[model samples]
Target: MNPARAPQSVPARLAQIALYGVAAAAVAGLVALIVSAVLNGSLTRSGTADALGWGALILGFLSGAVAYSQSGQSRIESTMRARLGEGYRAPGLPWPQILAPLIGAGILSAIVFALN
Candidate 1:
C-alpha cells in the first residue's frame, strides 16, 4: 500500500435507487401484462374490483398527503427535506392542480394498460 494513496470516494445510498427503480418498473410492466392476460379469463370481474381498490387506496393516501401540505419555509424544513428531499412550487389552480396530474397520469396508465 502506498503512503500517498488517494482517499476513497464515499458511496451515496441513492445511487442504486435509480437502477432498481427502472428494474422494478420493468418488472411491474411485465406482471401487468400477465395479469391482463389472466383477467381476460376467469379472474375478469374480481380483478377489476381489485384494481379499483388499489387505486382508491393509493389516491386516498396521496390526497391526504396533499392536504397535510408542507411545513414551508420553517425550521423543520431540514427534517422534512431529509425525509422527502426538496419541494418544488406547483404552478396552477389549487383544485385543478390537485386533480389534474393524478388524473392525467391515471388516464394515460389506463389507456396503456387497458384490459379490453
Candidate 2:
C-alpha cells in the first residue's frame, strides 16, 4: 500500500470537495465585500443597508456550513442507512477543523450585520 495514496471513498471525496468549494466561495465573498466597501467610500444608510443584505447572505452560508460540519457525518450515515439499508459504511470528513474559519466568519458577520 502506498502511504501517499490512501484510497478515499466517494462520499469522503465529495465531502472534501464540498468543504473546499465553500471555503473558496467564502473567501471570494469576503474579498468582494471588502472591495465594495473600499470603492463605495462615502456609504449612505442605503449603501450600508446593501452591505447588511450581503452580510445576511454570507451569514446564512456560514451558519449552514457550520451546522453541516457539526452533524454531516451523522446525517450521511442516516441517509445511507435509509437509502442503502444498514451496514453501509464510508469515510467521513474532518469537518469541525475544516469549517472553523466559516464558523468564525459566521459569528463575526452576524455581529457586523446586527450592528449595521
Candidate 3:
C-alpha cells in the first residue's frame, strides 16, 4: 500500500478541503429538501428551519465519522513507522475534528431556537 503523502501546499490543502465542503453542502441541501417536503408537505419557513437543523445534525455526524477515520489512519501510520525504526511522536489532537461537531451543534441549536 502507498504511504499517506503530505499535502503538496497550503493552497492545495485548502482547495481539497473546499471541494469536500462543497460536496458536503450539496448533500446537506438535498437532505434538507427531502426533510422539508416530508415534514411540511411543502417548503415553509418552519419546515426549512427544521430541515436545516436536521442537516446540521447530519453534518456533525459526518464530521465525527471523518475525524474517527483520520484518527485511525494516523494511529496505523504512526505504528508502522515506529516498527520500521522511524521515530514516532504522538499525534496532537486534531482541532478540526474537535471543533466541527461543536459548531454544527451550535448551529442546530440556534436554528431550533429561532424556529420556536
- Report, for every candidate in turn, its global Cα lDDT versus the true structure: 0.46, 0.60, 0.69
Model 1 over residues 1-116: C-alpha lDDT tens digits? 78558554434323343344344334444454466557676446446545443443454455446544633344355556667877745333344334433453354346445653
Sorted by TM-score (best first), the order is: 3, 2, 1
C-alpha-based local distance difference test score of model 2: 0.60
Q: Find the 10 residues in a row with the least total lDDT in model 1.
A: 12-21
- C-alpha positional error of residue 111 in candidate 2 after TM-score superposition, expressed in Å: 15
Candidate 1: which pairs clash?
none
TM-score of 1: 0.31
**Tens digit per residue, CA lDDT, model 2, 26-107:** 6645664676679897565556556645654664576577667657777777787978767655556555454644544554
As a whole number from 0 to 100, the lDDT of residue 39 in candidate 1 is: 65
Superposition-based RMSD of candidate 3 using all C-alpha atoms, in angstroms: 6.2
Q: Output the number of the lDDT-best candidate.
A: 3
My TM-score estimates for the predictions, one after another, are 0.31, 0.37, 0.56
Badly placed stretches (over 4 Å) of model 3 are 1-35, 38-41, 97-101
